[model samples]
Target: MSGRRLAELLAATETQTPQGGQAVSFEPLGWVWLKAGSRRRRERTEAGVTRMIETMRVETRADPRLVAGRVLRFDGDDWTVVAVEVDAERPGRVRADLERRP
Candidate 1:
């Protein structure tokens, strides 16, 4: 996925409870490779999982200065990010892959 999408996903995967309950974290299941001559496959890794969780946290904060992307993924849909791995792109930018069930 592109950096824009990743930023969007990260911003959407987060939610705030009534009184800011234990921040729920959404970890990336894995990436499904869409190959040309073979069936799709998924490769899960710790780094991916970590990125998923961190992005959620970064986007779900109380700061209103953060900018979130428009990329979104619904539940049951397969998605992954290859580039733009982290949410440290620039100031006031929350990097994330917005793949969460609303």
Candidate 2:
């Protein structure tokens, strides 16, 4: 896809700061595309009881500054990035699995 199309799809702005050992701060990184993935439920045993855990995927451009554990504000909601994967075929794209912040 063309960069223009990609830019148009990237309607959300995200802010993140370099991960330092101490305090956490954020700086705007401009607009980015945010795509939601399908919902998944996994059964897990916790405290001797079965529970269902839910997760979803979120895709965006390949931004070097974005990393796991960063809180992203999108669509008036806060999402925490759990994992990041770069698309080998499309070097400029990236996929991130996000979980809604509680």
Candidate 3:
């Protein structure tokens, strides 16, 4: 089967903007293309109880404002930026791990 390049993969994702308002403290940054990479789930047992933590891994264009501890609104939900890296997989893009925030 034929394979696709990194630029092609990044181009496939749709562009979106962060809901810049009182919800976010800083000024609006550049547009980001969100690509749903994967979902991670971890189970921890503590005090005879098991807790499940879920997070989502997404890829987007490198943006300075998209950093850890920032809450971003997209797809009708708010997701907190757990971690972010520049060109971890390829150049000109960023990989971010997010956790759904209620």
**Predicted model with the maximum TM-score:** 3
Candidate 2, residues 9-29: lDDT per residue as tens digits? 122344454763455455555
Q: Write the per-residue lDDT of candidate 3 for residues 1-102, one digit (tens) a residue.
A: 112213211111233447643332433343465777555678767799987766787777777777787755555555668899887558889887877523
Comparing 1 and 2 on lDDT, the stronger one:
2
Candidate 3 regions with alpha-carbon error over 4 angstroms? 1-31, 44-51
Quote the RMSD, in angstroms, for model 1.
12.1
Give candidate 3's total backbone clashes. Answer: 0
* RMSD to truth, every model: 12.1, 8.3, 9.9
Better of 1 and 3 by TM-score: 3
Cα displacement (angstroms), candidate 1, residue 38, comes to 7.4
Instruction: Candidate 1: list runs displaced more than 4 Å.
Output: 1-13, 19-39, 47-78, 84-102
Candidate 3 pairs with clashing backbones:
none
Worst 10 residues of 1 by lDDT: 30-39
- Model 2 is weakest, by summed lDDT over 10 consecutive residues, at 1-10
Task: Rate residue 56 of model 2 by lDDT.
Answer: 67
Candidate 1 structure quality by residue, lDDT tens digits, 1-102: 211122223333556788976564554332221211111333335755632221222132223323343333433343233222233644543333322222
lDDT for each candidate structure: 0.32, 0.61, 0.61
- How far does residue 3 in candidate 3 sit from its true spot (Å)? 17
